[model samples]
Target: TLSEIATMAGVTPSTVSRALNPAASHLLSKKTSERILALCDHVGYRPSLLARGTATGFTYKVAMILHDMEKDLNAHDWNRITCATSAFLQESGYSLVLLRTSEKGTSMDMQVSHFLMSGIADAYITSPSMLKNNTLEMLNSLKSPLFVICEHGVPFPVSDGVLRSDADAFKQVWSRIPKEMHGKICFLSTINDNTQRLLTNIKRAAWDLGIDANNAISTLSLARTSKVPAMEYAEAYHQTKKMIKSFNQFDFVWCISDFFALGVKDALTECGRCPGKDVFILGYGDLETFPGVSEKPVLSTISANTHEIARNMCSVIMKKLDGEHTDIVTVKSSFISRSTF
Candidate 1:
């Protein structure tokens, strides 16, 4: 059937073969490859994995380790980063081994060591739940090749490069808020470098604008555990809710995460205060679909643009593997202004 079709198209079986496989498609002209694929679809042609594998020395597999799939998927920047990284990895001729490192029994450190010990994957790209757990410190000490997705100490030992969130420079953006809004502004985030960086940056901005940073209090949520401790989120909700009560004048509430802020929003509603109307809410990591969630005080946020983050991490891996050394790169953040002013 292949030869018959190739003859009718005035092309050799080898041309058809090249068109059938993506790795070989470069040998065929773009139009020829397109026509071949179109005709192959008509004939239901598929490439044989066995032959392809023998030709290429690589199984083209990569292992990705993250803390929480829910948060990882729901998180705005990191989610986009992982998805984009996966796409790039696939197109670059590699498969993904997605590993949820911080499950109930498994420690993130152990997960990294185990994967490294297995030696099954070509390389590793890890987004250690730096905020959720204290794993980033430990993950840094490992001997394997790794890429970090968060900010920590100066440099990582095992990590040839780091891809950090641009939230560190967020203070620059927050500083631009009106001088009157400085004391009225509240910074939010879980206890992480990026969160602290956000606070530090804003506080500096606040100071420059003659605003008191103390007017804003930072509240940390559940540790980066496999599953957020049942009470951690609840306690944070209550604590923030309670803190909100102490404020006689709070104009803006900055939350590190949108999903987490949703919890805070719930607490505010319990107090009979309408969000966005009575209080403004700003969130980082524009993640979560807010499924079955109604519009209560529009939540404004900045997206982490993880697509670039992921791509950068992958590029770092490729460069390092090629004996190139580069400094860690930070991914840019995006802002969304909702009615939560």
Candidate 2:
């Protein structure tokens, strides 16, 4: 088919090959390349990814390893991050492959080793939650570059790293609180691995403003309780209502997620406190645009800017591919104003 297309376009197989490869296509003239491409299209010729990879020693696929593979993929933040990553990579002639740390309770190290040895991906990307000792060993052994994305801006030893600083986001929301309400700030989140880090960041933000966090910040973790990712909304609703029944002693409330914020808002209202007037509420991970969520959300929140993070990740990968070194990148979160605050 290559020779046939070359012949039809009055060119040699070498020229046709150059035209087919995106990186090498620039070597040919615009007119010649267009002619060859148009002829190939006319004859319904499609290049095989496997064949191209075998010949060039590159699969053009990036593997994104996940820590909690059991979590629902339909969750808004997960969906946004993955979709944005995939779309960005696709623009640069690459594809994304999702690999869970464990599958059916199998060893994560073994799974990671298998994928590494198979040589199916050109590069690797992962978060701190998914990084393991042996897994890091395998990734280090490979010549392919590894990129790390820190979801909560945690420090890690990596040449290429991207940090989406939840601290900055929390700080932005904190500054919006009225000065009088500084000492009455209440934060509510479900128990999870990153809860402490998030809490620390929130307090650190207040401390940076010369506020004594010990006296100003109060935290509740629903008392050692955890909910599945999908059922967080209902869990937050019931738990928050119970808490409100006992005590409501805060001028400003900040939640780890929009679901929790919504729960707190409803609980406050049902208990005779107005969300905007009697108390102020803020949340993270803007959920107004999420599927099955209300378009007209009343809660003020912070956006993680998943699309921007995806672009930066791809930019780092591309730089590595071009034999350039990049420093750690920190993307700041932005605040979205709404009726609640």
Candidate 3:
């Protein structure tokens, strides 16, 4: 099969081998490696990782520990990160193995221990939440090359990390609103430690911007019992309707996520309130516009730069695997102003 691939690529079998090898791939010309990789992909030829590991003592597999794989797989940021990480890893002749630590009855310690002992993967990439548990301890004790993606909060000192400026991004979004609307702002977010921190930061920003932080800013936290993504939309819609009934003074709604903002917009329209004109709404996570959904209101939100995050995350992991020290990387967020807010 290697010979066949080499023949197709007009290279020798040894050259094909080098192109497919993560460590040795750097020896080959970029053009040659890309051509050989294209042929391999076109032919659907996957090198046996087990065999290669046995021969070279490297699995060429990278384990990705997700917070909650099922729920996060549907979420916009997680989906984009997964795609970008997979693409970058593939280019480096590595494959990704996903593991969920939040699943019921799933022991993260045992899973990580098994991988370490069995040589299932050479390096690991995980969410910051894993640092709160014994997962980080186990990985550190084993001296594994670990890279963390700081999506929620500050991560434990691992090898390196990719951090997001969530609070700063929120402040940026808040600052863009008209000063008059700042006094009538309502924030909708999930009840979590990280969100509580974000809420505090938002309040601080409000005070700094001369908005009445105590009386003007209002907040509602949704219970985190459901993993169903659509439940977020439903809960947001229901709460917006209830907020309208109880306090119809607020003129702006800032949701923690774009999905929730969509629900808030729907509720406003149903209640005979114009989203942009009567009550502007803002959301985080600049999710892609859905296909065949042109009539949906355009949401002004912060783009977390999921693609760049994933790229840098993988880059840091690769550097660690190559015995290079890397520092924590912070990716800035940008505001995407749309029709809604």
Candidate 4:
């Protein structure tokens, strides 16, 4: 096949081989390499994995480890990240293998250990949740590169990963709030590490802006006991309705997510309060649609730019695969202002 491609490109077989090899391709002239590559493409001549392995000693496979795969699969941010990462890895001539920590009766530790021993992938990209206690230390012991995608404020010791910038997003939102609503803003968030970080950022920003942080920021944490598929919306609705019944001092409410914001709007309507008129509502994550909210007000929220995060993540992994060190990367979020604020 090499000989055939070389003859068609008017180059020797050895020259074609060198041009096609990833490591040695740089040694050949640009014109010759491009000609050989074009010829190979025209012929649909994908090199055999066995041959490539013999030459490079790499599996060319990257594994993405996800926790709570079923729930995350439907999540907009996770879906976008997975799709973008897969596309980028494919473009870089690598295949992606997805491993769910919750699969089978196997624990996260067992799954990771098995994969490490089996050599199923050359490198790994995982969520911060998967790297807890001994798991992170175990991964660090391996020769293979490991990358983590961490929540906005969760501290990750490793230097090769991406951290979402929820703090920046919160600051942007706080800075843009009307002066009239400065001391009358309420925050509704789920009791999670990421949301806690966001709330902390909001409080810090308020303090920095000379606003009374304690009086300006009122927070309600929705419990995670509910198992409903739409638990976020349901919890927000119930909690907000309760809050409205007892306390109605706040003029603006910021939710941790758009889905929760929609529920907050519904609760406000039930309490005889108009969403945009009586109280402006804000949320994070620019979801496309919210169910049961027909006349949806344009929501003021933060867009995480999952695509950019995925691209950066893939770039870091690629650098690691090439035996290069990568610094920790943080992807900043942008605020989208609309009628809700």
Q: Which residue window of length 10 is worst by lDDT in model 4?
A: 288-297
My TM-score estimates for the predictions, one after another, are 0.68, 0.86, 0.80, 0.82
Alpha carbon lDDT at 21, candidate 2: 71
lDDT at 283 for candidate 2?
83
Model 4 agreement with the true structure over 133-213: per-residue lDDT tens digits: 324554553557778777765777677788877666777777877777866787877665346667777788777777677
After superposition, candidate 2 runs with Cα above 4 Å error: 6-38, 72-75, 103-111, 132-138, 191-193, 224-226, 245-247
Q: For each predicted model, how many residue pairs clash, with residues at least 3 apart or on different chains?
A: 6, 0, 0, 0
The better candidate by lDDT, 2 or 3, is 2
Per-residue C-alpha lDDT of model 1 across residues 1-341, encoded as one tens digit per residue: 66866886689988887787555689888999899888888877665555555665444567776666676665445556677888877665566787666643457647666765656465767664544565555444334466667653334545355545444345545654566565566665554434565566546655665556676444443434233423334644666666666432566677766755666677777777777777777766655433344445366766666667778777777666556776677666666666654
Best by lDDT: 2
* Candidate 3 runs further than 4 Å off: 1-16, 21-48, 100-111, 128-135, 152-155, 190-194, 204-216, 222-225, 288-297
* lDDT of every predicted structure (CA atoms): 0.62, 0.76, 0.75, 0.75
- Shift in Å, residue 169, candidate 4: 2.0
Ranking by TM-score: 2, 4, 3, 1
Q: What is the lDDT of candidate 4?
A: 0.75
Model 1, global lDDT? 0.62
Q: Indicate which candidate wins on TM-score.
A: 2
Better of 3 and 4 by lDDT: 4
Tell me the TM-score of model 4: 0.82
Task: State in Å the error of residue 244, model 2.
Answer: 1.4
What are the root-mean-square deviations of the candidates from the true structure over C-alphas?
5.5, 3.2, 4.0, 4.1
